[model samples]
Target: MQVLAAGGDLAQLTASGLFHGASYGALGAGFALILGVTTRFHFAYSLTYTFTAYAAYSLTAEAGLPFWPAALLGVLAGTVLGVLLELLVYRRVAARSGGDGMMPVFVASLGVGVAGIALLQLVWGSQSQPYYGPSIEPLRAFGASFVNLDVYQAATSVVLVLGLAAALRYTGLGRAVRATRGNPGLAAAQGIDVRTVYLVCFAAGSFIAGVCALWYGLQYTVDPAMGTRPGIYAIVVAFLAGTSASPLRVLLVGLGVGLAEAWSGLWLSLQWTQTTVFVLLVGYLVIRAAGPLLPRRLVGKGA
Candidate 1:
């Protein structure tokens, strides 16, 4: 029984990992927009994700609202907050600092993330808040088990990933985003508002993240620190996919990451989940770093 529960079945592990990866894909989709388009990152963006979940949790738990409406409103609040942070805080910092570099922006983001998590703790306490909404029953088949929520989560992530890719490829805003990502200065010269693109990315990213957060609230528990670890993993996915790549590629990379972690669970303990991600990241970085110096044939370059 213990062996079966761990990683006995490859099919089971792959199914589980794909579902887990769906959440990562949703998160990476949001973060990728900002990182790829605006060329700015906020450690605090994950805080926005947490804030979205808590907002809905508060409405449902405290105000006695239904789960769906509360979640919808929570998404609005989070989206607004994200835009505000970009407009009020990030923009002002950039203006004040004269757009010198990313260092100031990152510092400011880290500071906000710390402060935001602390505030969540103060207001909500340190308890893990789980939703008691409509129970999504577990589904079982092919010697595997999963929940209906996992299906919804995966479907939603797939739609969003495809939507994002289509928008970037075919829409007016997509053109602007691609242009800004490629060369902000040239984009501005072409009459694109780089700042507006940044704002839009924040709003869009935050909204998508909020939706993803809502799924987490339904399926799992929420806490002030809920977004911290997942946020780190999403950042890794964003980098792995890179700026200007197909957003659907983010989904594929996320699935790969999930597979790696899930397979690792076959032998490793539960506590080692995060370590797997970091190990993969480090391995990728090492290979890239060495690729330049290795012989062309060995590196598979000029082939």
Candidate 2:
């Protein structure tokens, strides 16, 4: 508390944390969708976002394309690639492995992530590049300030989360996903087209990734490994947020994480940012794990 009070700029740090949290929340929800429907935790998902950001950047900065066109192309490329991964790699592996295919799928995603980085290096030369886009001035209020880009990014995340929540709750496609998630065999028997659900979910998740990547690129330089850090935090947040289908919880948790990370810099070294966040993850996992165990133990004692 003292450190934070004495810190160079508390307001700026808080604002930074909020923006970072919003990004993490969106990414976490995206991962949660894939996890809930497909039962596969894709470690390589970050690569898709990073790659799309780079692709969009290259299209606009190098190929001389308009911003929206380049962004559209990049988003399409990323979504298509995500669907292809599901159809080509994960689907085949799942078919072969049957009930316990998650491990195999995870391994394949890891491989994909590595391959993505290598390909990025091969094409983009592993150098960080600036994002080309329209400039916006900073917005300030009550001694706290942020750029318009930050506001856009944060707003985009919140809107996407709400939109996803609405789609999942009120749409036919959402019903198919919920049905498929509940029991694939039953859903298939009911002619829910489970495979289609998987494909759509994966593509949707990837589309979110691409959108996030565009904003991320706008805020920071694009590089091959840019997604790794945020990816880890987002995945952890998804797990911490539990099985609730609401994105609002994820958004709150993401903000908490961002606050913790930003405030840690006041008292801890810069290198401890991730470590601090992971500690929170570890603590949450332990507490959640204990929840079920404690109930079972109480039941046993009562019996």
Candidate 3:
């Protein structure tokens, strides 16, 4: 009877939103890890995502491998490809066009991304690749229904996020990554291989992207440009969480955003839901930017 149930019941929408949000958490956290640590904008991450999805689809549909194995192999291939991008393209540019990277990093990333997109389009064309990996039955509970893939995706995200948090909090490698993120120059001076740290971030980030690609292709269709929206959303979440935000915090923020997006469907058309989410994000950013300039209220009715 509530307004939020105009299109569907609250329970159904909430269930869907929660699962969708879990993917967002994973995507956002991965982007943040690389961007925060490596200082690379990584526009080419979309290429990695697309390639991984297609690779998995090929293995499953053409090679006759099971979905899980295909996904794992595809993720591995994508991870290697990402590391190659870092080592072959980004690192070389950083060396040649050095000076606190006035503009070269941006130019390099943009160029590589464009070139990669063109190549993919040339090879795969603009046709959407449908995934026929597995047959799934919708599961229902509490008057809500969802598929098994949703639960698997959410569980994987939660487990990985928690493991990442623990590693960042308590491990020696974590301390090194923290130090490098804080000050690469100081880290290099202290005998920390800053380049190695960057490499690690890229590998981890790309591996996450591959996992996302797997779940995404399974749930939806795959296309060369499929990564565009997810990539943009991940960047927004990373910035929304800010430089100081913990990985767990990023995941929580993503979940909250997912819920907001779902609730927004109560009033807007499905076509406009994504746009509304960005509008809301912009409003939040404006308020955050203005908050620091505003004066605080006096406590206890006294100055």
- Model 1 reaches what TM-score against the true structure? 0.93
* After superposition, candidate 3 runs with Cα above 4 Å error: 1-8, 296-303
Best by TM-score: 1
What C-alpha lDDT, on a 0 to 100 scale, does residue 217 get in candidate 3? 84
Candidate number that wins on TM-score, 1 or 3: 1
Give the winner by lDDT: 1 or 3: 1
Candidate 1 residue lDDT tens string, 1-303: 133355347677888889878878778878988877766677787899999999999999999998889989999999998888888888778777875746677889999999999999999999998776777898987777888888888898888888888888899998898899889999999999999999889988898888888888788898888888778978988777664567788889889888998877776776775689889888767766798787767646422
Ranking by lDDT: 2, 1, 3
Query: What tens digits encode model 3's per-residue C-alpha lDDT throughout 176-259?
Result: 888998988999999999999888888988988888888888888888888888787777777777644678988887787777
Candidate 1: regions farther than 4 A off? 1-8, 296-303
The number of clashing residue pairs in each candidate reads: 0, 0, 0
Backbone clash total, candidate 1: 0
All candidates: TM-score: 0.93, 0.92, 0.90
- Which stretches in model 2 have alpha-carbon errors above 4 Å? 1-8, 292-303
lDDT for 2 in candidate 1 is 32
